[model samples]
Target: MLTNYHTLKNLIIQIKPKLIHSQIVEAFTQEKDTLHIIIAGEEASALELNATGQGYIFLRPKFERARKNSLDIFPEIFGDEIRDVLIHKADRIIEILLSSGLKLIFQFFTGKVNFFLLNQKNEIIASFKNPKDNIGKIFESEKKDSNYDLMLSDFNAFKDVWESNKIENPVLRFVKSVDTIDMLTAREILHRAGELEAGRIWKALVDVGAELENPKPRIYYEGSFPRYFSIIELTHINLRKIEFDDINEAIRKFVIETRVSKSYRDEKKTIETKLNELVEKRKRTIEKVIEEIENNQRAQQYEVYGSILMANLNLIEKGLEEVELVNMFSEKGEKIKIKLDPSLSPVENAQMYFEKAKKTKASLKIAQERLERLKFEIKQLENLLDELALCENFDALKKFKEKNLEELKKFGIVKDKLVAKVGGKFKRFIVDGGFEVWVGKDAKSNELLTFKFSDKEDLWFHARGTSGAHVVLKTGKRQPSKKAIEQAGSIAAYFSQARTSRLVPVVVTKRKYVRKPRGAPEGTVAVEREEVIMVEPKLPSEEIE
Candidate 1:
C-alpha cells in the first residue's frame, strides 16, 4: 500500500531526479482518480498517480506503452507549463508548483490519499476527491522542522503531548506525536513489540522510528502480486519480501500493472454505457418518427375539403373570408368550416385547397420514407450492440472502439474524432457439399453482399415478400446440387419474418437479376427471373468448413 509513510519516503529517494524544474508536457487521466503526468527535461519521464484507493506514485514508461487511450480531461491546467517539483523535507506530501504559483499537492497519508492543486492565494483549483470536505477543510498548516524530526528531541515533545492530552485512539495519538508516521507503520510497530499500550510499545516504536532516518525499502508480495511496500522489514510470514535496488522501479512496475487492468475495465464500462444509451434514444426516435408519419397521413382530410368546396361553389360570394358547407364525403353530411382568402375568387380558393392537399400528400410520402430509414438505422445499431457484448478481451474492445467510436461521436458520446462509417461484417456459414453460404447480418450488410461481394452468376435467395437477410450461395459458375440449393433456401427462410412458420416461401435468383433502385433503402431490391421454393425455416444439420 502506498499510503505507508515509509513507502513514500523511500520512493522519493529512489527517484532522485536530476532536474527539480521541468515543463508539464501533458497530462492524461486513465480514470476518475488515476492520472499520468509527463515532465520534460534532459531525461523525460511520465509519472503515474492514483488518489482514490491503493494509490501509488512511480515513474511510468512513455505514452506509447500506455494500454488505453489517453484522455485530456483537464488540458488547460497541465500542458506545456513549467512547474517546480518540490518534495518537502517532511514525508507527507509532494508539491508541484506551477509557473502561475498554483501548487499541485499529492498527499500520501493513510485514509486520506488525495491530490489537490491549489492557487497561490490558498484557493483550491482542482482535486481528485471531495474537495470541500475531504481536502480543503482538513489541511493543517505546516509545522516547524523540529516537529517533523524523528530524533530524540521530537520524541520527547511527543511524549509530553501524549501525557498531557487524553486521546483514546492509539493511531491518532501516534500521528500527533511523530507528525509523519501513518497508521500502517504505527500498527506494525505495536505488532512487533506485541503490545497495545503506548508505554509498553515505546522501545519498539523508537527502534522503528530510528530506521526511518536510514531507510531500507522492501516490497511484500502475496503469490507474485505486490501487496504492501515499506521501508521497514515486514513481519508477516505469509508475505514474500521482494528486495529491489531502487524502490521506484518496484513501485513503477506494480502501479503500471494495476493501471493496465483498471483501464480496460473502465473502457469496457464506457462502451457498454454508450451502447445502452444509443439503443434507448434510437428507440424513442423511431417512435416519434412513426407518430409524425401518422400525423402527416391525417392531413389527407385537406383533399376532402377541396372536393366539398368545388361541389358547393354557388354558396360562396365575392370577398367572403369564410364559408360553411356540407362535407359530402362524411356519412352524416356534417357542415365544415373552410377559411378563405378574401382577395382570391371562389375558384382560386378552391384551387388553393387543392394545392394544399397535393403538398400534404407529398409530405406524407417523404415522412414514410424517412421513417423506414430511421428504423433501418436502429436495426444496424442493435446489431452493433450485439457484437460489443461478445467483446471478451482488449483487442476485441479496441477494434470495436476504433470502428464504432464515430457512430457514438454523432451523439457526442465520444467527441474527439472525425465521423467515419462502421458496421459489422457478414456472417459466414458452411453448408453441405463443401459449399460456402454467406448471410447478411443487417441492412447494410445485405446490400454489400448482394451487390459488391457476390459474383454475377452466384445464386441468391431471400424469403418471399418479407424482410430478411440476403443469403448468397457460392456456385463458382457451376450448378449446385438440389440439396445445396434446398439448404440455402432453409437458411434464407430462417433469417426472415416467417422464421416460425411451418413452411416459408423463398425466392431464388442469380446475383445479376437483383438490382437496387436509386436512393432505395438498404437491403431493398427488384428481382427478375426468380424461382420460388417452399422449405421449413431451419439451419443446416451439419456444416462443413
Candidate 2:
C-alpha cells in the first residue's frame, strides 16, 4: 500500500514543507493516467502523479517539463500560491488548497486515479479525465468511513473483520479484506508473527500497524532490476535492499526501475508473439505452394487426355459420361477412360480438357513465382526476429515495433487477435467464380446457418439421411454453376456422419424452403422443397477461411 492512509498522511506532511509557499507554474498531462504539476518556491519541484493499473505519486526533484506531446490543463490555477496540503480523512486522497480558494484534489484509489479542481463551494469545475461525470458534483472522498481505519484502530475490530474474512491465509485475507493493507505489509506481518493461531492473528497485525505509523521505506531488487518497494522491513523476501532516507525517493526509484522494465518486457513479448505467427503463416503458405507445384506435374497427362478426345471425336457419342479410348501417350497402348460433362458436345468436351491443360501450365508458373517471393519474405521476417531478440531496452523494442508494424499487419497481425477471420462459427470456402460456401461446425451453428445467415436465394445443403453441417452456397443474385453446386455438395457430405461412405446423397434446396419446425431441437429443420444430388464425399483442398 504505497499510497495507503498513513503513508500518504506522512507523504503530505513531508511534501507540505516544500509546496507550502510554492507558486503554481503549470499543470499538464503527457500520457494517459498520469499528470505533472510544476510549482516554484524556494526550490522548483514537479509532482508526478500516476494512476496506472495501480496508483502511485512521486516527487521529481527538478521542475522538469515535457518538451513535446504535452497538453496544458488546469490553466486557471496558474500563479496561485499553495496554502496547505492535507489527506482527506484516512483515505488515499490529497487535498491542495491555494490562496485563491481553489482546491485541487488528487484521489489515488487503486485502478481509479481522478484529478479534480473545485471552487470555494466545493463544486467540481473541471477534471482531468471524464469531465461530464465529475463536473458540477460536490466532490468527496469515497472511503471516508471505510472499514480499513476501524480495523487498524482496535484489536476487537481487527478480529471481527479477520474472522468474517474467508481467505484461509491471514496474510492474503488482510490484503483482500482491508482496503489499505497491501501484500508487502501483509507478508511482512505474517513473517514477523511466525506461526499464529486464529485467535492470535492480532499479534501479526501489530507489527504492520506500528510500521505504518512509522515507516522505513526501501527498494528491493533482484539482480539489476528493482522488483518491489516497501515501507516495512520485508524479511520474507531475500533480495538486495537499497534503503532511502526519504520514502518519496524510495518510491521514485522503485517506480522508475520496475515499471520501465515491465514496459520493455511487455512490448518485446508482443513483438515476439506476432513474429512467430507471421513465420508460421509463411511456412503454411509455402506448403500450399509446394503442393500446387506437385499437382502441376500432371499437366502433360491432361494434354494427353485432350489429344485422345480430339482424335476420337468422330467415334465419341453425345450424353456419354465417359468414353474408353486408346491412350495417346501410354506405353502399352492401354485404353483409358476420360470423364466428360454430359451437356457438352464431343468437340466442346475436347476443348474443355485442352483449356484445363493450358490453365494448369499457367498456374504452375504463378505458383513458382509466388514460392520465390514467399521465401524472400520469410527470410526478411526471420531477420526482424533476430534483431528483436537483441533489443536491450524499451526504446529499442519500441523502435523495432514501429519499423515492422506495417509489415506485421500486412501479414494479418492486428493488435491482440492474429489474422482475425470473418465473424462466424461456420467454415468458409471459395469455389470457382468466387462463390462463397459456408459450412456449420455444430448443431447450434447449423440452425443459424440455414435460417439466419443465409438469404432467400442462397442454396442450402445437408446429407440426405444422416446428421451433417448445414452448408450454404452464397450465390446471391447469380445462378450457381453445376460444378459449384457439386463442390458444396461434397462439403456437405464431408462434414456429415456418413462421410466415410464412397457416395453420399446430399439434399439441396433454396434457403427460403428450409424452416425450423416448431418445438424442434437445434439443427433439426424441415424442408418444404428439396432436390437430391449424389457425389463422392471429398472436400476441396483449399484452406477454410
Candidate 3:
C-alpha cells in the first residue's frame, strides 16, 4: 500500500493511541496541479492542488515546547502569488504560536490551525485544523472545571482519567468516547459550554468535523482535496546481520574448495607425467635386451658351421696319407689336406658347439618372451595412467573413485566409506527459522532463484514500477510476519533504481501468482493478487560493516 492520503488516515485511526505530529518541511506542485507535501516524519508525502484559484487548508500542531525558530514551514505551490501569501501566513501563525504557546492557531484565509494535545501513550499528539468558534466551548465542556486552563484541561484530561490511562491524546479520546453524539449534538454541547457567539465560525468547524472523520493526510493546494497523500507503515525485520555471517561462511568454503580442487589437478598432472616417463624408459631397455640376444644367437650359429667344415677336412687328410703312390702319378691333381688337431676333433667340437647353440637359443627365447610380456604390461599401465590424467580435478576424481569403489566391491580392492560434502557451497538455507527465502543479485540470478530453486509456496517480492532484483520468501509452513515481509521488500527496493527514492513502491505476491510465459526472457513474469508496500530503503547495519 503506497502511503496515500486515505491509507495514512486509516493508519492514524488504527494506531490512535498517541500524538500525531505532522511537519511539512517542503511541498511541490505537479503539472496536474496536485500538491506534494513532504513531511519530516513520513519518508515521503504528496497532495493535489486544485486548478481553481482557491487554496486548500493545512493544520499544524501547537506545542508548548515549540521554539520561536523551530517552525520553518514553507509554501511550495505553483503560483508565486499564492506561494508568497502562504509563506507569509505560515510565518505569522508560527510567530503567534511561539509567542503565546497557543494550542491552536488559525490561518484565517485557509481556515486551518495547528492543534496539539496529549494521548493515552503520553506522546505528543498534534494535527492541523480550521479555527472553530465553538473550539473554546468544546474545550470548556471537555474539562470539569470552568477555568481557562489550556494544558491542564485539554492535555491533562487523558493523563488524569485513570492511573494507567491509555487514552492520552485528545483526538483518540474524542474518537473513543464520543460514539453516541452526532456532530450537531457535540456542537450544541460546545456552544453552551463556552458561550460562543460566532455562528459562521461554528458552522465552519462543524464542516471541518466532517472532514476530520476520515482525514486523508494530504497537502491542500487550491482550497480542495485535489491530490490525496497517505502514510503507509512499513514493517521489516533485521536479517542482513544474520545472512551476512552465513554468506561469509559460504564464500569461505567456496574459496577453500576451489583452491583444493586446483591443487589436486596440478598434483595429478605431475604424477601422470612421471609415470609416463618411467614406462617409456622401461620399454626402451627391454627392446635393447632383445636386440642383444638376437646378435648372440647369430654368433653361435656361425661357430657351428665352422666346426662342420673343419671335421670334413680332417677326413680328407687321412685318405691322402694312405694313397701316397697315387699322388706321385698325379701331383697336380692331388688335394693337399692337413690333419686337424686331436684336441679340436670333429665329434667333440660338434657336441660342444651344439650345446652352446642350444643353450643360446633357449636363453634368447625365454628373454624375448619375458621382454614381450613386460612391454605388454607397461602398455597397460600407460593406458591406465592416461585415464587417470583425464580425471581433471579432485571433484571428478572423487566421483570416479566412488564409481570404481562400487566396482571394486566385487574384486575387494577396498572397503566402502564415503566422505564428501553433501551439498554445494552456493546452496541456500532458511534463516529466521524455516522460512525458505531466496535472494539473488541480478536478473539471471533472480530467474534462478525463483524458477529453479523456489517452491510454489514461496512468496516473491520486487520493487513495483521499477527494475529490481527478485526476492523470494520461502514460507514452508510458517506464516510470514509483517516485519519479515517489510525486510524482504526493503531488499527488493534497495537493489532497485528506486533505492535512492524517498519512498519506493514494492509489490509482493505468492509464488503461485507469479508466472513466466513461454519463451520469455529471464526474470520476466506476470503476477496477480499481490500487495504493494511503499517503504524507504534502509540498509542493514551489518551491511555497512
Candidate 4:
C-alpha cells in the first residue's frame, strides 16, 4: 500500500532521515516496474518503490542483488550521493536533494510512481518518465494539508472534530477532517465499530488510531498466494495471514510475490522448450536427408539397367513381354531379366528408360543441396542454445539475445532475419601418406567437409551408389598417394550403409568436382570427374597430426 498521510507522517517521524550527506551507491530494478535504491553511510539502507496503481514505498532489509539493469535516470539525479531526504508535510512525496544540487521527487501519488530530478534552477534534468517525452506534466511541488493534531488514542479529541464537521457522509467527513486517515483505514474502523452512524464513528476512529500506532503488518493470502497487505489484522478468517514485525518487510514480500516474476520464469521455460523442438526437428531432417540419399543411390542403378537394355536391343522383339540379357557392366556376363512393355517398340522403351534416369539425376542434385542447408541451420541452432543455457539473469539473457539475434531469428525465437551460418570443423584423421582427411559425423558436418572447409585442390570421397559421409583429404603440397586415397575411401565406405560389405565401391574425386546444387539438403552433393575404387570398409585408426 502507498504511504497514506497518517502512514507517511508516522514513517517520517520513525525514519528521521536527515541531511547526513550519505552516498547513494546504486539504483536499479530487480522486480519488474520496481525501483530499488541503496543508500550507504550512517543510514545505510535500501529503498524499494513501485508506482503502478498498487504502488508502495518501503525499506528492504537486504538489497535485491539480481538487478536486471542499472537505472539510467537514477545516476543522472543522485550522482552516487544523496545530500538530504525530506518528506513534504502530509504529502506522500519524498524530496531527495542530491550532493550535486539536483532534486529528485519520488511522488507516491496512487498512480504510476514517477521520479523527477530537477537542477538547482528547478528545471527538469532527467526523469524515469522524462518530461521532454510529453508523457504527462510534472508538478513543481505537491499541495500539502494541515497535519492531524489529535492524539491517536484520545477518543474525546476525535469526538469533538466529528461533532464540528457538517459533511453528510460519515466516511467522507472523517477523511476531510483528518489529514492522516485513508479510505481503507476509515472503512476498517467503520467495519470494526459495527455501525456507519455518527454515534459509532468515534469508537471506530479510536480503534483505527490505536491499531495504526502499534501496526501489526500482515499479508493476506488466498490459495497460497498473497492477495493484499494491511496494517492491522484482516477480518477475513478464510484467507491465510502471514505476519511480519516490520511493515516494510510485509510490503516487500507482497511486491516480490507477483505474476510478473512468474512470467519471466515462463519466458525462460519457453526458450528451453523451443530449443528442444529445434533439436528434434533437426534430427527428423537428418533422417529425411539420409533416406533421400539412399533413394538417389538406388536411382543410379536405373542408369545401369537402361544401358544393358540398349546393348541387347538387337535380340529384342516387339510384343515380347520380357527378356534375359547379359550384363556387360558386371565382371562376369551375368544374365539379367528385363521387363518390357508389349505395346512400345524396342527403341521407344530404351528412350523411356533414359528419360527416367535423367529425372532421378536432377532430383538427386536438388536433395543434396537441401540436405546441406538444413545441416548448417541445425549446427548454428545448437551453438545458439549453448549460449542461451549460460544466461543466469535477465540482463545476461538480453545481452545474449542482442549478440545472437540473427541466429535466434532463424529458429523463430526472435523476429525473422532470413540468414544462416553453415559448417564447422569435423573429425580429422591422417593417412600413411601424411595427408589429413576429415570425416563428417553428421549431415551438416558432411556438407561442411565437401563444400565449405575443403579447398578445390583437396580430394573428396564417398561410398559409390550408397549413402555415406563426405570425406575430404587435404593434399597441401603433394598429390595424395594410392595408400592415402584407399584409406580415405575405406573411411567413407565404413561410414556408409555398406559398412558390413567385405568390398564396397567408393567414388573419389577432387574437391573442385564436388558441387552443392541450389536448395539441396545437408550431406547431399553431386560428384563429377569421379573414379570408383573398391575397398574393404573400415575406419581409420591414426589421429591427424
lDDT of each: 0.71, 0.81, 0.44, 0.71
The digit string of per-residue lDDT tens for model 1 on 223-291 reads 444666677765744587776666677677666545554676687788678767777876887788678
Candidate 3 lDDT tens digits, 325-365: 11222348553332233455454544555666665775676
Per-residue lDDT value at 201 in model 1? 60
User: What are the per-residue Cα lDDT tens digits for candidate 4 across 140-159?
Assistant: 65565554545344556766
Better of 3 and 4 by lDDT: 4
The TM-score, computed over Cα atoms with residue i paired to residue i, of candidate 4 is 0.47
Runs off by more than 4 Å, candidate 4: 8-14, 17-20, 26-32, 42-44, 61-71, 76-83, 99-101, 133-138, 146-183, 259-444, 447-545
**Candidates sorted on lDDT, descending:** 2, 1, 4, 3
lDDT value, residue 11 of candidate 2? 77
RMSD of each: 15.5, 18.2, 36.9, 13.7
TM per prediction: 0.50, 0.59, 0.24, 0.47
- The candidate that wins on TM-score is 2
**Ranking 2 against 4 by TM-score, winner:** 2
Instruction: Give the lowest summed-lDDT range of ten residues in model 3.
Output: 81-90
Counted clashes in each candidate structure: 0, 0, 29, 12
lDDT for position 106 in model 1: 82
Candidate 1 weakest lDDT stretch, 10 residues:
415-424
The true-versus-predicted C-alpha distance at residue 394 of model 1, in Å, is 12
Q: How big is the RMSD of model 4? A: 13.7
